[model samples]
Target: MSARPRSKTRATWLTLLGGTFGLHRFWRHGLRDAWGWLHLLATLTGLAGLQRLDAFGIDDAQAAWMLPLGGLSFAAAMLATILTGLTPDERWDAQHNAGRSGGTPPSGWGAVLAVIAALLIGTTVLMSSIAFGLQRWFEAQAEADLQTPQRISVPR
Candidate 1:
């Protein structure tokens, strides 16, 4: 550890702004953190999903699967932001800034605002993803129904 005090507000803001890239993880746990790398990979995969959607369009099966990856990644990042913001100052300092020169600082409005923003953005992304997935599923079911032949009963 660098022995430098970590600010809860900064961590919260980082999670809100760069959680998709694992910036907050890297800030807290350094470059060797596996979770941080996973975050980066997930974000990249999500970007790939976005590109696939752009090229193939919404109707494409692959796009349907791929696009949600990005949305889910972003929403997960927002959740992380909310969690980071809500963490108590004492616990946060003990975990992140133990034995540091300065003691824990009180979390201010910045963290609260970040949490609020995360909630709004995360909810929107999650709900939109669910809607998109359901719409695609329903469309596929309708198509399958149309393709299947219905048996006719003869009246004697």
Candidate 2:
């Protein structure tokens, strides 16, 4: 690890802005972190899902399933941002900046702003994903009902 102290503010901002790509994880754990690679893979998958949706349109069956991967990945990243921002400075310094000369300086307003933004964005993404999935499911069910042949009853 480098002798430089890890700034909580920078970590919080990275989590907010690039957590889906695992930038925050890379910052904390260095390049070899497996989780960082996983984050990159998942983010790429999510982007592919978006491309599929754009190419096939929302009604496409594959797109319907694929789009949620992006939203969920984003929501999880926002949650991580919130958690990182909310951690106490002392604890953050001890855990991430240990052996550094001065330890991490106070995060101040930057961490607070990151937490607020993450909460707003995360909640919106999560709710929208749920609503979109449910709407698609119901539409599919309705379409199926309409396509099915109805049975006629005769007087017995």
In model 1, how large is the Cα lDDT of residue 95?
Answer: 86
Q: 1-156 in candidate 1: lDDT tens per residue?
A: 456788999999999999989898899889999988888887787778778778878788877766676678789899999999999888888788878886766998999999999999999998987888789889999999999999999999
In order, how many clashes per candidate?
Answer: 0, 0
Best by TM-score: 1
lDDT of 1 at 76: 88
Q: How many backbone clashes does candidate 1 have?
A: 0
* Predictions in order: lDDT: 0.87, 0.87
User: Over 4 Å off in model 2, which ranges?
Assistant: none
Question: Global CA lDDT of candidate 1, please?
Answer: 0.87
The local lDDT score (0 to 100) that residue 111 gets in candidate 2 is 98
Given candidate 1, what's the lDDT at residue 22? 87
lDDT of 1 at 54: 85
